[model samples]
Target: MKCWCGKVLIIDTRRLESKFRDDGKDGLIEGVNLKDRIERNMNASSYPFRVDDSCHIFRFTSTGMKTIEKVVVFDPLPIPGIYMLVLGDFDEDEIDVGVKSNNRDLEMVLSTVVKIIAFFLSDYPDASIFVEGSSAARNRLYRIMIEKERKNWRELFVIKGIDEDTFEVFQSGKNYSSYLISLCKT
Candidate 1:
């Protein structure tokens, strides 16, 4: 099957902060990283933050599609902090978030992810998105994807436990589920 995904672009935490700084935003305060601010606010200097809150915007250009790939954090996220967007052929749009251990960032990135899909839908012609997460986290991933799809596309996008489940639910529609998860050593 021809994949709807195209190019991938990762905007890390540092980059987002830099963008905010350049854009004259204020969320990234005091030149201090969000992770540090959270830690300081809790008065737990060594306390680990929940997860890196980053935006994963998917942009479909007239040439190719683009998506986020990494998050730069001081205390690196235990989740897939480093993501390598594997470009695929016309058959599928593959984004391999090389997750060696846990997938804490997966859920956090979903909100931004949906918008990217929306970009594809509203902006691109006959556009769709395909997600491939590890089986360990596919359930949660599927849940979030499904919720977003349902809200936007109604039953038009039935993302279930896996990609197949999603495909089975709504065939010939926007297939937005994962086929496999990535395992990284680094």
Candidate 2:
């Protein structure tokens, strides 16, 4: 989808996965951290997508704050289907979301994602994205952020969950999440 700040694109999970296997990376348009993700994901748990069937992406911005068009790839999970699940924080961590779909078209899915982000940018000044339904799920989110995003990724970092009850910030490589984390906490 097209937007004033950027464009969003989604492709089939099979196509995305194949690209990752071929090139060792796919990126925001497809996904990220291919080779490392593949090796690490060998034993990653898979969840039934029933709960995720209605998944949506949301973005937010604080009053008078700038909208940084950074896309964070969060909770990248490989489901047993032709797709990989992707969650991300965007507009400089002002927004958070996950994308899940049974649809076959990537563009449609991603267009919707872009629209959702736009809504957050245009509307909600304070909003929270997904947290695990259980403590373990939230903890898993933290570990995933630490393990995958702690490297060469330039402009994105996952928001860490503290104790699955309160949220905290952790430094990922060169990124200082204090400011961003503070925004998220509210």
Candidate 3:
């Protein structure tokens, strides 16, 4: 199945099932140190999400001045064990990722995204989730959200930002073209 982002989701169910079953002894990537974890308070709120049977897709409703159906898809990338996080509105028969729903619920939507990420990592602890916005402005928005939650999230994830093909530890004030997140070793 091909996603709206044009990336073909070649889901090998057997491979995924096996990966999910394996113990995550080697989950943490090299070069990440335990001292790098950040601690802070996270007081964000989110809408409850419903997961599909495959657990690759999640749905939630955004309620504010307007009601919008939202879909979050964790599509497999070409690289093994990596997936791209796609967020979009659930249009009829398709997910329109480019559409900007001015629902005035940015914080709730982002908080819900974080919740979904946590849930996805619980099943695929070693998998790295990639996120890149549909537009430059949207990318900036994502960066801002990440920065706001960086300290709180660092305790749970090893967040990295990609700039000019280089993946470095995510830092505030630095602009990145994309982001990668994986479960932090407990």
Candidate 4:
């Protein structure tokens, strides 16, 4: 499959129906599945962000015979703080947040995270924030929360810290989520 952003997204479903049945999970939504199929057929793709160490845009070409020429490129966002948040899907969770960016400024990192949580919670009111790995991660996040509160930034109402790897996978589509999350750890 491909996204309009010109990035190839392939998900073979040769056994998906059987697997869903075996797991006793609800069937896939018809429109969503069809959309995925169309995306694959169209060979849509995108690279919303730049890949580090590369001067070129990420190109996603379809394996099929489609004249669809989708080009994906990176766009750097300016939030006046550390880190960036990208959205993606996971098998185990409905929503996940990852911190990405090497910027060591702790204040910017926390502010970015709070902004992400606030944005997501507006739609996913029941979503949880999962911090991964380090035991002290909770304490670090809390400290940032307190500081943000003092600075008059709205406190996030939902957060669950998990491990580093899980956050990494959820943030696969987003390149900056984990880097900022790591800044909070330090």
Residue 114 miss distance in model 4 (angstroms): 1.1
Each model's total of backbone clashes: 9, 2, 0, 34
TM for every model, in the order presented, reads 0.33, 0.24, 0.76, 0.27
Per-residue lDDT for 1-186 in model 2, tens only?
533367764433454223223232332122112123222423322111111111222222211133222232323224321122244434322333443222333232333332332223222334333333223443444444444534422122234434424445654332321112111212
**How displaced is residue 175 in candidate 2, in Å?**
19
For model 4, what is the C-alpha lDDT against the true structure?
0.30
1 versus 2: better lDDT goes to: 1
- Error of model 1, residue 83, in angstroms: 17
For candidate 1, the TM-score is 0.33
Best by TM-score: 3
Q: Please identify which of the two predictions, 1 or 3, would achieve the higher TM-score against the true structure.
A: 3
lDDT (C-alpha, whole model) for all candidates: 0.32, 0.30, 0.75, 0.30
lDDT of 3 by residue, 1-186 (tens): 677678987655464234232232343111112212221234576776666556787777899788888878899999998999989886544557878888899988997788788778867898999999887788889889988887688778888999787889988888888999898877
lDDT for position 85 in model 2: 25
Error of 1 at 69 (Å): 7.5
Model 2 — which ten-residue stretch has the worst lDDT? Answer: 46-55
